[model samples]
Target: MAGDEAIRLVSYDPSWPERFEEERVALEGAIGEWVVGGIHHVGSTAVPGMEAKPIIDILVGVRDLDEARACFDPLAELDYLYAPYLPEQMRWFCKPDPAHRTHHLHLVPVNSQRYRDELAFRDKLRSDPGLAQRYVALKRELAAGHPSDREAYTDGKSTFISRCL
Candidate 1:
Protein backbone atom coordinates (compact mmCIF):
# COMPACT_ATOMS: atom_id res chain seq x y z
CA MET A 1 0.00 0.00 0.00
CA ALA A 2 1.13 3.50 -0.71
CA GLY A 3 2.16 5.45 2.34
CA ASP A 4 -0.20 8.14 1.16
CA GLU A 5 -3.11 5.73 1.79
CA ALA A 6 -1.93 5.36 5.35
CA ILE A 7 -4.96 5.76 7.59
CA ARG A 8 -4.38 7.62 10.80
CA LEU A 9 -6.22 9.88 13.21
CA VAL A 10 -5.69 13.61 13.00
CA SER A 11 -7.11 16.76 14.46
CA TYR A 12 -10.47 17.72 12.95
CA ASP A 13 -10.61 20.31 10.23
CA PRO A 14 -13.46 22.78 10.23
CA SER A 15 -13.78 22.47 6.46
CA TRP A 16 -15.29 18.96 6.55
CA PRO A 17 -18.81 20.16 5.82
CA GLU A 18 -17.83 22.15 2.77
CA ARG A 19 -15.81 19.24 1.48
CA PHE A 20 -18.82 16.96 2.03
CA GLU A 21 -21.04 19.38 0.18
CA GLU A 22 -18.72 19.37 -2.78
CA GLU A 23 -18.51 15.60 -2.84
CA ARG A 24 -22.24 15.23 -2.32
CA VAL A 25 -22.97 17.43 -5.27
CA ALA A 26 -20.47 15.58 -7.40
CA LEU A 27 -21.85 12.18 -6.37
CA GLU A 28 -25.39 13.27 -7.10
CA GLY A 29 -24.31 14.39 -10.53
CA ALA A 30 -22.41 11.20 -11.21
CA ILE A 31 -24.98 8.70 -9.90
CA GLY A 32 -28.13 10.58 -10.87
CA GLU A 33 -31.49 10.31 -9.10
CA TRP A 34 -32.70 6.71 -9.51
CA VAL A 35 -29.98 5.07 -7.44
CA VAL A 36 -29.43 7.67 -4.75
CA GLY A 37 -32.24 8.03 -2.21
CA GLY A 38 -30.39 10.49 -0.02
CA ILE A 39 -26.79 11.43 0.57
CA HIS A 40 -25.55 12.74 3.88
CA HIS A 41 -22.46 13.79 5.72
CA VAL A 42 -21.93 11.02 8.26
CA GLY A 43 -19.35 9.67 10.75
CA SER A 44 -16.97 11.58 12.99
CA THR A 45 -16.35 14.31 10.48
CA ALA A 46 -20.04 15.12 10.32
CA VAL A 47 -20.25 16.17 13.92
CA PRO A 48 -19.51 19.79 14.68
CA GLY A 49 -16.52 20.62 16.91
CA MET A 50 -15.20 17.08 16.87
CA GLU A 51 -11.67 15.91 16.13
CA ALA A 52 -11.45 13.51 13.17
CA LYS A 53 -9.07 12.02 10.59
CA PRO A 54 -10.02 14.51 7.94
CA ILE A 55 -12.07 11.94 6.01
CA ILE A 56 -15.39 13.19 4.78
CA ASP A 57 -17.58 10.18 5.35
CA ILE A 58 -20.74 10.07 3.29
CA LEU A 59 -23.84 7.91 3.55
CA VAL A 60 -25.67 7.33 0.30
CA GLY A 61 -29.05 5.72 0.90
CA VAL A 62 -30.69 3.70 -1.83
CA ARG A 63 -34.32 2.66 -2.16
CA ASP A 64 -33.64 -1.05 -2.58
CA LEU A 65 -30.98 -3.67 -3.17
CA ASP A 66 -32.08 -4.12 -6.74
CA GLU A 67 -31.68 -0.43 -7.35
CA ALA A 68 -28.20 -0.66 -5.90
CA ARG A 69 -27.26 -3.47 -8.31
CA ALA A 70 -28.33 -1.31 -11.19
CA CYS A 71 -25.86 1.35 -10.17
CA PHE A 72 -23.11 -0.28 -8.08
CA ASP A 73 -20.84 -1.25 -10.96
CA PRO A 74 -20.92 2.18 -12.49
CA LEU A 75 -19.85 3.61 -9.17
CA ALA A 76 -16.71 1.54 -9.50
CA GLU A 77 -15.84 3.55 -12.54
CA LEU A 78 -15.29 6.39 -10.11
CA ASP A 79 -13.11 4.28 -7.78
CA TYR A 80 -15.81 3.09 -5.41
CA LEU A 81 -14.68 -0.36 -4.34
CA TYR A 82 -17.57 -2.52 -3.18
CA ALA A 83 -17.29 -4.04 0.27
CA PRO A 84 -20.11 -6.60 0.50
CA TYR A 85 -19.32 -7.70 4.04
CA LEU A 86 -19.80 -4.30 5.56
CA PRO A 87 -23.26 -5.37 6.87
CA GLU A 88 -26.16 -7.46 5.57
CA GLN A 89 -28.64 -4.66 5.00
CA MET A 90 -26.36 -2.28 3.16
CA ARG A 91 -23.75 -1.97 0.46
CA TRP A 92 -20.44 -0.43 1.44
CA PHE A 93 -17.66 0.95 -0.71
CA CYS A 94 -14.36 2.67 -0.25
CA LYS A 95 -13.47 5.29 -2.77
CA PRO A 96 -9.72 5.47 -2.58
CA ASP A 97 -8.21 8.77 -3.37
CA PRO A 98 -6.35 8.72 -6.62
CA ALA A 99 -4.61 11.44 -4.70
CA HIS A 100 -4.93 9.83 -1.28
CA ARG A 101 -8.49 9.74 0.09
CA THR A 102 -9.65 11.89 2.91
CA HIS A 103 -13.03 10.21 2.73
CA HIS A 104 -15.01 6.96 2.98
CA LEU A 105 -18.27 6.45 1.13
CA HIS A 106 -21.00 4.18 2.51
CA LEU A 107 -24.00 2.94 0.59
CA VAL A 108 -26.98 1.66 2.57
CA PRO A 109 -30.64 0.80 2.31
CA VAL A 110 -32.71 3.92 2.88
CA ASN A 111 -33.92 2.91 6.32
CA SER A 112 -31.63 0.23 7.73
CA GLN A 113 -30.67 0.02 11.37
CA ARG A 114 -27.06 0.63 10.40
CA TYR A 115 -28.08 3.85 8.78
CA ARG A 116 -30.24 4.80 11.74
CA ASP A 117 -27.45 4.04 14.18
CA GLU A 118 -24.96 6.06 12.16
CA LEU A 119 -27.22 9.08 12.08
CA ALA A 120 -28.17 8.58 15.68
CA PHE A 121 -24.54 8.35 16.72
CA ARG A 122 -23.57 11.38 14.74
CA ASP A 123 -26.43 13.37 16.14
CA LYS A 124 -25.72 12.06 19.59
CA LEU A 125 -22.10 13.15 19.36
CA ARG A 126 -23.05 16.55 18.03
CA SER A 127 -25.48 17.02 20.88
CA ASP A 128 -23.16 15.73 23.63
CA PRO A 129 -19.68 17.19 23.88
CA GLY A 130 -18.57 14.93 26.72
CA LEU A 131 -19.25 11.82 24.72
CA ALA A 132 -17.67 13.27 21.62
CA GLN A 133 -14.61 14.31 23.59
CA ARG A 134 -14.28 10.84 25.01
CA TYR A 135 -14.55 9.37 21.54
CA VAL A 136 -11.98 11.81 20.21
CA ALA A 137 -9.56 10.96 22.99
CA LEU A 138 -10.06 7.27 22.34
CA LYS A 139 -9.40 7.67 18.64
CA ARG A 140 -6.31 9.76 19.19
CA GLU A 141 -4.89 7.20 21.57
CA LEU A 142 -5.73 4.28 19.28
CA ALA A 143 -4.33 5.86 16.15
CA ALA A 144 -1.14 6.83 17.87
CA GLY A 145 -0.10 3.18 17.95
CA HIS A 146 -1.97 1.72 14.98
CA PRO A 147 -1.88 4.24 12.17
CA SER A 148 -2.71 2.13 9.12
CA ASP A 149 -4.49 -1.09 10.02
CA ARG A 150 -8.18 -0.51 9.36
CA GLU A 151 -9.52 -3.39 11.46
CA ALA A 152 -7.56 -2.42 14.53
CA TYR A 153 -8.75 1.13 14.15
CA THR A 154 -12.38 0.06 13.94
CA ASP A 155 -12.08 -2.50 16.72
CA GLY A 156 -10.82 0.16 19.03
CA LYS A 157 -14.07 2.00 18.52
CA SER A 158 -16.49 -0.94 18.78
CA THR A 159 -16.85 -0.96 22.56
CA PHE A 160 -18.09 2.56 22.78
CA ILE A 161 -20.03 2.44 19.53
CA SER A 162 -21.71 -0.83 20.40
CA ARG A 163 -23.00 0.68 23.62
CA CYS A 164 -24.28 3.68 21.71
CA LEU A 165 -26.26 1.31 19.51
Candidate 2:
Protein backbone atom coordinates (compact mmCIF):
# COMPACT_ATOMS: atom_id res chain seq x y z
CA MET A 1 0.00 0.00 0.00
CA ALA A 2 2.97 2.31 0.50
CA GLY A 3 4.47 1.92 -2.97
CA ASP A 4 4.63 5.61 -3.75
CA GLU A 5 7.71 6.32 -1.69
CA ALA A 6 10.48 8.62 -2.92
CA ILE A 7 13.65 7.09 -4.33
CA ARG A 8 16.79 7.86 -2.40
CA LEU A 9 20.23 6.29 -2.75
CA VAL A 10 22.64 5.96 0.11
CA SER A 11 26.36 5.32 0.25
CA TYR A 12 27.20 1.67 0.73
CA ASP A 13 26.94 0.69 4.34
CA PRO A 14 29.42 -1.87 5.64
CA SER A 15 26.71 -3.27 7.86
CA TRP A 16 24.28 -4.17 5.06
CA PRO A 17 25.39 -7.77 5.02
CA GLU A 18 24.92 -8.10 8.72
CA ARG A 19 21.51 -6.53 8.44
CA PHE A 20 20.69 -9.04 5.74
CA GLU A 21 21.96 -11.91 7.82
CA GLU A 22 19.79 -10.81 10.69
CA GLU A 23 16.76 -10.73 8.42
CA ARG A 24 17.71 -14.04 6.84
CA VAL A 25 17.78 -15.70 10.20
CA ALA A 26 14.40 -14.26 11.02
CA LEU A 27 12.93 -15.43 7.71
CA GLU A 28 14.41 -18.90 8.11
CA GLY A 29 12.89 -19.26 11.52
CA ALA A 30 9.50 -18.08 10.35
CA ILE A 31 9.30 -20.02 7.06
CA GLY A 32 12.13 -22.52 6.90
CA GLU A 33 9.85 -25.41 6.02
CA TRP A 34 8.66 -23.67 2.86
CA VAL A 35 12.13 -22.78 1.64
CA VAL A 36 13.27 -25.28 -0.95
CA GLY A 37 16.43 -23.66 -2.26
CA GLY A 38 18.02 -21.14 0.08
CA ILE A 39 17.75 -17.68 1.54
CA HIS A 40 20.06 -15.19 -0.16
CA HIS A 41 21.01 -11.57 0.12
CA VAL A 42 20.85 -10.03 -3.34
CA GLY A 43 20.63 -6.53 -4.97
CA SER A 44 22.87 -3.49 -4.70
CA THR A 45 23.21 -3.61 -0.92
CA ALA A 46 24.80 -7.02 -1.16
CA VAL A 47 27.75 -5.64 -3.10
CA PRO A 48 30.53 -3.80 -1.30
CA GLY A 49 30.90 -0.07 -2.07
CA MET A 50 27.81 0.08 -4.22
CA GLU A 51 25.31 2.85 -3.58
CA ALA A 52 21.88 1.47 -2.78
CA LYS A 53 18.45 2.36 -1.46
CA PRO A 54 19.25 1.14 2.06
CA ILE A 55 16.90 -1.81 1.78
CA ILE A 56 18.16 -5.34 2.18
CA ASP A 57 17.02 -7.44 -0.76
CA ILE A 58 16.29 -11.05 0.12
CA LEU A 59 15.56 -13.96 -2.15
CA VAL A 60 13.77 -17.06 -0.85
CA GLY A 61 13.35 -20.08 -3.06
CA VAL A 62 10.24 -22.16 -2.60
CA ARG A 63 8.95 -25.26 -4.41
CA ASP A 64 6.54 -23.32 -6.66
CA LEU A 65 4.12 -20.46 -6.81
CA ASP A 66 1.20 -22.49 -5.49
CA GLU A 67 3.18 -23.68 -2.49
CA ALA A 68 4.51 -20.17 -1.98
CA ARG A 69 1.05 -18.72 -1.46
CA ALA A 70 0.96 -20.37 1.95
CA CYS A 71 3.72 -18.06 3.14
CA PHE A 72 1.56 -14.92 2.98
CA ASP A 73 0.12 -15.36 6.47
CA PRO A 74 3.43 -16.26 8.07
CA LEU A 75 5.22 -13.40 6.35
CA ALA A 76 2.43 -11.07 7.47
CA GLU A 77 2.97 -12.19 11.04
CA LEU A 78 6.59 -11.16 10.58
CA ASP A 79 5.30 -7.78 9.35
CA TYR A 80 6.08 -8.38 5.66
CA LEU A 81 3.41 -6.92 3.45
CA TYR A 82 2.59 -8.99 0.37
CA ALA A 83 2.49 -7.14 -2.93
CA PRO A 84 0.86 -8.69 -5.98
CA TYR A 85 3.70 -7.86 -8.29
CA LEU A 86 4.38 -10.38 -11.05
CA PRO A 87 2.32 -13.06 -9.33
CA GLU A 88 2.85 -15.39 -12.28
CA GLN A 89 6.61 -15.38 -11.75
CA MET A 90 6.97 -15.07 -7.99
CA ARG A 91 5.57 -13.70 -4.78
CA TRP A 92 6.89 -10.28 -3.73
CA PHE A 93 6.92 -8.69 -0.30
CA CYS A 94 8.30 -5.74 1.61
CA LYS A 95 8.75 -4.79 5.23
CA PRO A 96 7.84 -2.92 7.28
CA ASP A 97 6.07 -0.96 4.56
CA PRO A 98 6.41 -0.59 0.79
CA ALA A 99 6.65 3.19 0.76
CA HIS A 100 9.59 3.08 3.10
CA ARG A 101 10.96 -0.43 3.02
CA THR A 102 13.76 -1.81 5.11
CA HIS A 103 13.78 -5.05 3.19
CA HIS A 104 12.43 -6.62 0.00
CA LEU A 105 11.60 -10.29 -0.37
CA HIS A 106 11.26 -12.22 -3.60
CA LEU A 107 9.91 -15.75 -3.37
CA VAL A 108 10.78 -17.67 -6.49
CA PRO A 109 10.77 -21.32 -7.46
CA VAL A 110 13.95 -23.20 -6.64
CA ASN A 111 16.43 -23.41 -9.53
CA SER A 112 14.24 -21.21 -11.69
CA GLN A 113 15.86 -18.86 -14.22
CA ARG A 114 14.98 -15.87 -12.09
CA TYR A 115 16.46 -17.47 -9.00
CA ARG A 116 19.71 -18.25 -10.80
CA ASP A 117 19.87 -14.89 -12.59
CA GLU A 118 19.39 -12.97 -9.38
CA LEU A 119 22.37 -14.70 -7.83
CA ALA A 120 24.37 -14.40 -11.00
CA PHE A 121 23.81 -10.65 -11.21
CA ARG A 122 24.84 -10.16 -7.61
CA ASP A 123 27.92 -12.29 -8.10
CA LYS A 124 28.89 -10.51 -11.28
CA LEU A 125 28.70 -7.14 -9.58
CA ARG A 126 30.61 -8.45 -6.60
CA SER A 127 33.45 -9.62 -8.82
CA ASP A 128 33.67 -6.49 -11.00
CA PRO A 129 34.12 -3.15 -9.31
CA GLY A 130 33.90 -1.24 -12.57
CA LEU A 131 30.63 -2.94 -13.39
CA ALA A 132 29.29 -2.19 -9.95
CA GLN A 133 30.26 1.43 -10.29
CA ARG A 134 28.49 1.67 -13.59
CA TYR A 135 25.40 0.23 -12.00
CA VAL A 136 25.64 2.71 -9.16
CA ALA A 137 25.86 5.57 -11.61
CA LEU A 138 22.82 4.33 -13.45
CA LYS A 139 20.92 3.87 -10.21
CA ARG A 140 21.67 7.41 -9.10
CA GLU A 141 20.52 8.83 -12.41
CA LEU A 142 17.38 6.73 -12.33
CA ALA A 143 16.62 7.70 -8.78
CA ALA A 144 16.94 11.36 -9.62
CA GLY A 145 14.74 11.04 -12.68
CA HIS A 146 12.07 9.05 -10.92
CA PRO A 147 12.38 10.37 -7.41
CA SER A 148 8.85 9.43 -6.40
CA ASP A 149 8.10 6.76 -8.96
CA ARG A 150 9.54 3.52 -7.69
CA GLU A 151 8.21 1.52 -10.64
CA ALA A 152 9.69 3.85 -13.23
CA TYR A 153 12.98 3.99 -11.40
CA THR A 154 13.16 0.21 -11.37
CA ASP A 155 12.02 -0.07 -14.97
CA GLY A 156 14.74 2.30 -16.09
CA LYS A 157 17.36 -0.10 -14.79
CA SER A 158 16.04 -3.21 -16.53
CA THR A 159 18.11 -2.79 -19.66
CA PHE A 160 21.31 -2.39 -17.69
CA ILE A 161 20.48 -5.34 -15.49
CA SER A 162 19.64 -7.49 -18.48
CA ARG A 163 22.92 -6.67 -20.16
CA CYS A 164 24.78 -7.55 -17.01
CA LEU A 165 22.96 -10.82 -16.86
Model 2: CA > 4 A from native = 1-3
**Could you list the CA RMSD of all candidates, in the order they appear?**
2.6, 1.2
Worst 10 residues of 2 by lDDT: 1-10
* Candidate 1 residue spans exceeding 4 A from truth: 1-4, 35-37, 85-87, 97-99
Number of the top-ranking candidate, with lDDT as the measure:
2
Q: TM-score for each prediction? A: 0.85, 0.96
lDDT of 2 by residue, 29-145 (tens): 989999989999999999998899999999999999999988999899999999899888899998998767899999999868999999999999999999998998899899889
**Pairs of residues clashing in candidate 1:** 55-102
- Residue 116 shift from truth in candidate 1, angstroms: 0.5
The true-versus-predicted C-alpha distance at residue 153 of model 2, in Å, is 0.8
